[model samples]
Target: MPKKTEYVLRLYVTGASPNSIKAINNIKSICEIYLAGKYALEIVDIYQEAEVAKKEQIIALPLLIKKFPLPEKRLIGDMSETEKVLKGLGLQS
Candidate 1:
């Protein structure tokens, strides 16, 4: 049997901006529907924790990083594009 994959995701946002809020909500919804009990999500507010963003080399306001399961993936913007985000995370809609 194949080993189950556990997803480790990091979301970097700047304060409570609309794009940031949208990204957070979208990712949470996706995780609940797809990753459910097998995922760890860390939401980082760059405005409050600038060092984290700098250390992660975040260039965008709302960025999603899939840190686990090898070949880490990154998604930028508001994360409103569900299909694209899902594809980036190697998941089917």
Candidate 2:
């Protein structure tokens, strides 16, 4: 079982593209609603910090990663699909 109200997330995005912006905003909104202050969000802009992205082995933009509470998970896209995003991070039933 996992501890309550603990989350560590990393979002990797490109420049200021629409999809990237949408991904950042959507993840922020979701995390605020669901994880709130218990969450630690790290936003990495690949265009500005490609080193970080390379270290993470990211090949694409707008990637959301849940990296705590045991096994990690990754989600790619603008994060418009709640179910997919939640399930990817083991947040849904």
The numbered model that scores best in lDDT is: 1
* Model 2 lDDT-worst window of ten: 1-10
lDDT of each: 0.89, 0.85
Error of 1 at 12 (Å): 0.4
Model 1, 1-93: lDDT tens per residue? 553559999999888999999999999999889887888899988888878776888897799999997789999999898899999999964
lDDT of 2 by residue, 4-84 (tens): 658889898887999999999999988888777788899987888868776888976699888896688888999999888
Candidate 2 lDDT score relative to the true structure: 0.85
User: In model 2, which runs have C-alpha deviations exceeding 4 angstroms?
Assistant: 1-5
TM-score of each: 0.88, 0.87
Q: Which ten-residue region of model 1 has the weakest summed lDDT?
A: 1-10
Among these predicted structures, which one has the highest TM-score? 1
lDDT of 2 at 81: 95
